[model samples]
Target: MYTEHPGSCSTTGAIGLERTRFFPRQLITPDDLIQDQIYFRDKLRRHNRLLHGWGVVCGARIKPGTGECEIVIEPGYILGPYGDEIYIDQEVTVNLCQQGTDGNAISPCSDMTDPWCSNIRVDRQSNKPYYLAVRYAECQTRPVRVVGTSCGCNEIECEYSRIRDSYAIKLLSELPSTYADPMPQPNLDDVARCTPDHACPACPTEPWVILADITLGAGSKVTKEGIDCFAHRRHVVSFANYYYLCKSTTLPVVRSIFPGNGINLNNDQALLREWAQRPLLKITFDREMAMPKLSEPDAWLRFWQLRSDDNLTVVRRIFLALSPENPPATDESGFTATYQLRAGAQELFQSRFLIQIRATADTITDTTTPPNLLDADFSGTKLSSEQLNQVWNVTDQTTLSIEILNNLSTTDATLPSGDRAAGGQFHSWFAVLG
Candidate 1:
């Protein structure tokens, strides 16, 4: 038998297959047909795992139920780690909040959670966070036709004629460990299929689909503090949209960074054509956030720098603009003192720009505080510099920065802030320019 794999990563790569060649009057055994069926089945499983990827598509929300320790999992679609599709038409409720009261009862190491709570949770003495996940499952059933029922040779056909596709909802202490991309040693079946290197990574882990991290006290009701759904829950966009993006069929062309923020962009045909050619990546501060209310002036962030020619771009820092960019990319004094994207005259705001705050009333004597952003009124509605601390009626970080950045040029980002609260949390998305 011959087999092949694509790309450098063998485990993730697709496996090659072989078909039996039959001649007239050639005897075909049950093994030959079984192999034939497996080939097609493996083909589709690989497609889903490799190309489409895996994650919860929609509606696997964890919500508090009427019971003290119960949580409801709304009906949803999930793609398992091994590319198995799990569709729950109705809501599945897993009770993590309670367990049986029998003190002497020995609990199963793990309960088999499928077919909607077929087993009960075994209460552990201590209360800790349980990692909830789902994984693809299969079972052999539908026994039919005994051995030698028809054929006189007494050779058994297939013991189980059918395989059922199912899923399991499990509570895990940690993520299941990953195994070798493929099993090292080869058995008869492995030799035929798991060829080349003979290791398949997904075999061990069951490729769990993590639902949430939850904790429940002995008799406490489920509360917001116990369940953290967003921490581990991975979101998957619709397949059609993601597939289009994966192929790069349609490129995103953004005309302005601050389109609806009252900043008119330079939309000349020449510039528009130029922008169409270059890639644009941006972070939009959509939610309102206030500057950290603190007593010390030096504690606040001075200059939030944008990308420079010398700066090493870090994609992770897209949303955490308030935090410092590590190792200090550039010492170059920015061209603009204002909050403009570009430094030069032909500015369309595509360039990554720095965000500077008006830390103090005196921009010159208190140079460490940087300059006021937005309309030069970083401290809005405040009567005195002493009262410029975070208070009621203070504009959000975005609004306050606009006022100063609109007036002056950006400063050096050599100095950065460590405070997470200083920056507003916002969602970041990326698109490629054709």
Candidate 2:
């Protein structure tokens, strides 16, 4: 229903006039009125989704909550997965440390044992990762008092208004709450797609973009210690290209955790920049060693794509030549010897895309030895557009191959010329508009 093009007017042809026609003296029932109104409403939503894509269009910012495990969502507008519009015209609060689905307070689990988290829809406490996302919803409003019939069935019914267009802020797990499923893999196309819990109240299958990756320290109970003290969140990104907000790899954007945990991700992948009603994605990072004993990697890339669906940020074709934040490292020869540089792993994507390769340091110095030209030296060349196109332009390519020749220095004459390469670059591209 979402994949069709918006160029044709027939998209709303699901209902014909013949279905709504009433002959002279024909009576129109309330059912007909409701049906026609709902049909047109749904059509309009689908049309919006088909044309403009989805995500925050204006001012819905996140801020810290006054209570424990609470987050405040500022007023804003957004287009949901089904193209439904969610308008948060006022501020609202959501408790991240939720233990129930009814939006009611429940005593935190003391031991924190939840086995059926994945089988049925249940929230679990984990020290790992959870995503903060939002969706569209609505409820009863502006009640009109009406006299009850002889029967008391109208106690909960006969409401004047039933508005159904509001935003829902929630914390969700990308993976099912169960242990049977393997680790969820990052979508090569859409970062929001995941092996989610089908029964999730947060609409697992709906088009909801991630805002951030939230982590809770072990044994955090809302009834006891506060989430403000235990929860941590972050949003990370690398250089997508010079056109991006953060053009340089050396200084990729990093929105670290704050008191309110307001950071945006997965929403700025579109050509249009964020102003108001902006959706967001949050993440966390744990840097690793670049080389066996060498220092951490200093360069990386934040590759991405621009498409019709702003809510869906696909995994662009990336060349994994290094771990810009912290590439993996290993020692081959031994101590006091040249550290073996392991070239980055081959990157794979399911598209024909361009890549950026950056390398630095024309020479290497071994201070351990006395002057006079020591042993090892490193050599590298910055990647050119033509060079990247040689592999990226291939009509049938998924995996990116890395070259170890010039990027590495075969030093340590004392040890055999071990295969060494230092090509660590950043991984994914999820830009944030300042």
lDDT of 1 by residue, 382-421 (tens): 1233222221123322233333222223223111211222
Model 1 lDDT, residue 44, Cα? 66
lDDT of 2 by residue, 9-88 (tens): 22234454323555788787866556666567667776666655555566555555666455666776676656677677
- RMSD of every candidate to native, in Å, equals 23.3, 27.8
Q: Over 4 Å off in model 2, which ranges?
A: 1-19, 99-126, 142-148, 151-161, 175-204, 217-434
- Each model's C-alpha lDDT? 0.42, 0.37
What 10-residue stretch in candidate 1 is worst by lDDT? 425-434
